[model samples]
Target: MLVISYDLEVFTPPCSPGALTFSAIARLQGNIAPALPYLNAVLPNAVYNPGAPALVWKDGRRHVVFHADHLAVSNLEDRNAAVEQVERLVRLVNETWQERGQIEPSYAVRQRPTPMMLYKLLPGTNCRECGQATCWNFALKLGAGQVTVADCRPLADPIYADRRAQLLASVIEDQFV
Candidate 1:
């Protein structure tokens, strides 16, 4: 396994003193730089920087960063959640390393679409079916990785097939695929 041991540190973010969410960092015993490109290839919407030898990804509402020596996860609920997330990340690294041969490593940096860019591709109905106040709000959440394209019910309409196709192809990550 690439990551067999780690030291976990969990704490509330200094920038948000009153916030309830926590963040955690796993100081790994092994260098995970070699597995980054493989992770970049498998994790949809992941941003990889070969120069920094780091990979950034969004797991639901959480922000995760994988460095050569450490893995950091933010926006966790509690200490247990933090620990669980770190463990999950370590497993992900080890699994990716083991399966590297089956996966094609990606070194190219991919930029995530901006909120405005995603908004243009949306149906723009402002229907609030997605529980957001507006289409722009949904777009912002989508771009931030807080919501998926499927959350927008209007996009399921036959009339919006083309726009849905464009959004999924360009902005949204198809996790099922």
Candidate 2:
């Protein structure tokens, strides 16, 4: 296992000390550089920085950064949740390491879809069917991984088929971070 154990430190958000939610950093025992590319290949929306030897991805609303010697996660519910997330990441690293040979490492940089870019493709009907007030709001959530393209029901209309396909290609296909 690339990561057998780690020292976990949980703390309130530095920018908002009074915030109820917390963040955690797991100081890994060993480096997991070898798994970075493998992870980059498998994890959608993962941004791999070969120069930094780090990979950053998202789990729901939580942001996870896998460094050579450590893993940091933010927007956690509690300490236990943080530990669970850390363990999950450790497993991912080990699994990726074991399957590295079969995986083609990706060093190419990928840019996430900007909200404006996403908004441009949306139907712009201000349809509240997506639980959002407007297409722009939906785009914001989509960029944040908080909502899915499927949530925008208007996109399913045949009239928007072309735009929908474009959105799928640029965002949905890479929105699993």
Candidate 3:
């Protein structure tokens, strides 16, 4: 296992002081740099930086980042949640490492689609079917990985098939589509 132990540091998010959400960083004992490319290949919508040798992803409102020998996560309910999240991430890394043989390593950098770009492809009608007030709001969440393309129900309508195709091809995560 690439990650067997770590020291945890939990704190309130600096962006929102005293906010209920917290963030945590785990100082790992082993470096998982060698497994990053494999992770980049297998993890849908993961942003991998060859220069930083790191991989980052957003699972709903939570942001997760993996470095050579460390892992950081944000948007936790509390320190206890942070601990569980970090341990879960460690298990993910270890599992990915073990499954490396079945995956192709990806060194190519793929840029995340911008909110404006995503908005252009969205149905202009403020249908609120997705529960968001506007299509633009949906675009913002989609760009940030907080929501998936499937959540925008209008996109599935046959009338918007072309735009939907474009979105699935460009902005949507590989796993979701």
**Which tens-of-lDDT digit does each residue in 58-169 have in candidate 2?**
6666777788888877668888998898888888899889888899988876666799999999988896998998888999988887877767877867799677666655
Across 4-71, the per-residue lDDT of candidate 1 in tens digits comes to 79999998866457768898889999999999999999998787877766787877767788889888
Best-fitting candidate, measured by TM-score?
1
Q: Write the per-residue lDDT of candidate 3 for residues 64-177, one digit (tens) a residue.
A: 777887888866899899989998888888999999888889886767779999999998899999899999999998887777776887776788867765665454333221
**lDDT agreement with native, every candidate:** 0.80, 0.77, 0.78
Better of 2 and 3 by TM-score: 3
TM-score of each: 0.64, 0.62, 0.63
State model 2's lDDT.
Answer: 0.77
Q: Kindly report which residue stretches of model 2 are placed more than 4 angstroms away from their true locations once superposed.
A: 111-177
Native-referenced Cα lDDT, model 1: 0.80
**How does model 3 fare in lDDT?**
0.78
Residue-level error in angstroms, candidate 2, position 145: 23
Best by lDDT: 1
- Per-residue lDDT, model 3, residue 40, is 83
User: Candidate 3: where are CA atoms >4 Å away?
Assistant: 112-177
